[model samples]
Target: MADSIAELIFIPAPGVGHIISTIEIAKLLVTRDHQLSITVLVINPPPTFGSGSAITTYIQSLANTTMDRISFIELPQDKTRQDSKAPMAAFTDFINSHCKHVRKIVADKMSQPDSGRVAGFVVDMFCTGMIDVANEFNVPTFVFFTSNAAFLGFKLYIQTLSDNKNQDVVELSNSDSTISVPSFVKPVPTKVFPTICQSQEGLEFVLGSARKLREAKAIIVNTFLELETHAIDSLSKESTIPMVYPVGPILNLEAGAGKASSDDDIIAWLDTQPPSSVVFLCFGSMGSFDEDQVKEIANGLERSGHRFLWSLRRPPSDQTSRAPSDYEDPETVLPEGFLERTAGIGKVTGWVPQVAVLAHVAVGGFVSHCGWNSLLESLWFGVPSAAWPIYAEQQINAFEMVVELGLAVEIKLDYKKDFFNPKADKVTAEEIESGVRRLMEDNKVRTEVKEMREKSRAAVLEGGSSYASVGRLILDVKRNIL
Candidate 1:
């Protein structure tokens, strides 16, 4: 088995971010060990979510890349109707339904003489249900945790909450009381707990999934040790926890570095700006704002008197609509003459090459939704953030950035988007102006990020923490030594 090629099958949740990040890890393992081969099993989301165009495109880009050890296969859509469950539960149930297909694929891989030794399975945290399929094969499993270590510890800590303790969490969310997690340095406001896990069933689902992590041989987290020293330390100290490997920030740096894409017009504009002069405002792919909210942002940016690049998309008609479309005429949404007023100083575009933009010399600060991926990307480029988090676990991420990490200026840590009424808890222009100014003026944060950028780059090198962790992971998978 050691003489034959070792194959690693990666099962990522159907989200684009999850898929791409998982591929980055596969690319790393293959590059480090010439004996490794990777097969990424792609499962498209159920039909209710609009077009799967982005997901398809991202995978195609990988297939077209120069890497030969990595391969991608799209699984047949499950199409199993799980509407009887809650939204989050339904989505997870959808992932669970694909286990039979996963089992078949692994069986087929093992049967082929030239397919190499089945190293083990690498499943996304949300797809822990697939652990059963791995146990059936008597094979080891690893989880590619896409979030930060603090969030991971928070989940594990909450798993201790059962019966009366669980109800107290519900009450904490309903009220404004704060709670303590061993992972975080200070008390965490209950409002910032993951919005999905607020309900009793949601908490059970999150805890239930995270609890399965212990069954794995190890977990490959997309973070570096220096960034989350306390949380990572706590996780490592636990003897019962799965072997935790911090082998990141695993980004496709070459693809993002100095490479011009179809979004060259945006890049060309950045070329004209002075070094570290522009503030970038981008919500994630699902990010959009109401006209009133848009005007507020416009009012804020115009008042800040700073060069800026904003990626603004049209708000979806309702929450069920998965994709947000770009407006044909952005002027219709912005305040009249706002563009003309900031003509030389600002550019508003639909979609952006996020990493390429952050890599630009002229870009100074990021106004972001604080998605874990976005946070790591901005940090890699040595750019500070004015956090404007929306939905998901972004609120928790924002809190960590501002209060714990000191790498960001907070705009609104708890601004979740309202699909029905967009004006609900709208952040005012005053807040945006102050946050942008603070993001740029904070010498302390900027210096810390610049230092972190050097440390981040080093973490993946031969002797660095991330490099060591990856080596440990490879040995464990190759030898089943854990």
Candidate 2:
């Protein structure tokens, strides 16, 4: 059976982050099981979503693989997204559009005798709609969850929020009651609920996806069990949900595309700084702020009086929503003389490689938007973080970090848009300074992060938990094939 071959079809959503992690998961599976092969199906993203140069470069780099086990199929751009819909709708619609293409592709693979058994389908977090196509072929399906266990549990348990089915989620979010979910150890404050889920469309989309996940054989999460023991355990005991696999901290370390750092200047600057000296402030690829917020950040960093590496990006100019672009001149939004005063202690640049910067010996503290991948990278590199969630499920991840796990220091300030005060800075200089200071100076957080760092590396090793989890997943897929 070990010598018998089988193939897994991967369908990742068009976002760069989703594609990158899907590739990592594919790579990890094939590496662990000699009998396995992978075929990745990529959806062509809309033009307004950015050039997708990052995904292009990443796929190109993998051209040198030793064995020709992994393959890619770029699906045609048949899905014309409704720009006015929420992001969740766009993703679901785009992926749902590709169902016929995927069905045809899988049918072709199944017909080819040389391609091996069609073992299973691995769909992205938002791509669960593909499960029906897999069902049509009588193949099992697995959902690759890109976030932490906490976020997964939140999504799965979120069906209870249907009482607000007719109400706007934003109004529901404003309610005074705390949230008690089966998966979380503590009651989550309404303030930290994901901003997107506060909308009617977004809530419906999230709940819809969560319900669909129960149809899969299991969910492959990008986190180690040791890091999220309570959430993982809570999710595993759920009889209704499918099997839960914790096979992660799966990261793409290539420079530029994902959390990789490749800038020569950023590396050189870090090389000169002393070990455990610099504080890194990088929100995820999409994180950026208005001029008021940018100024507040500068003030806060300056007040911290620590050596800093800040990835400062400007919000898109066209007012069409997209990832933040690097400022041609960062000094434009910065206060007068702010750059001059902090020149000796700080280096500001556009989009520093996150994992690359986090791995630096000089980086000690991280003030982040608490994206799941970024949080995992921070743990893998042993740097403590202060959570400043901007949007998406980050607020939930932040709550789990600050309240449930104590793995990160909390940055008190909502990153949500204030319609009443559009230009107002959400966080004060003092609050930012406080979070960074605690992250850097607090021994407890540093100690716990360092221990988790050891556990994270060990989890991927030969006999570690993640390694075992992958082994179990391989066995399950093979059994499904037979």
Which lDDT tens digits does candidate 2 get at residues 299-410?
A: 9889888889989988766634465778889999998899899988899899777767888899999998888988888999999889998777888888888778888998
Model 2 whole-model lDDT (C-alpha atoms): 0.81
What's model 1's lDDT at 293?
92
Who wins the TM-score comparison? 1
TM-score for each predicted model, relative to the true structure: 0.94, 0.92
Which of the numbered candidates is closest to the native, going by highest lDDT? 1
Q: How close is candidate 1 to the true structure, as a TM-score?
A: 0.94
Worst 10 residues of 1 by lDDT: 253-262
Q: Candidate 1: global Cα-lDDT? A: 0.83
Superposed Cα deviation of residue 152, candidate 2 (Å): 0.9
Off by over 4 Å in 2: 51-67, 79-81, 84-87, 161-171, 257-262, 319-321, 417-425
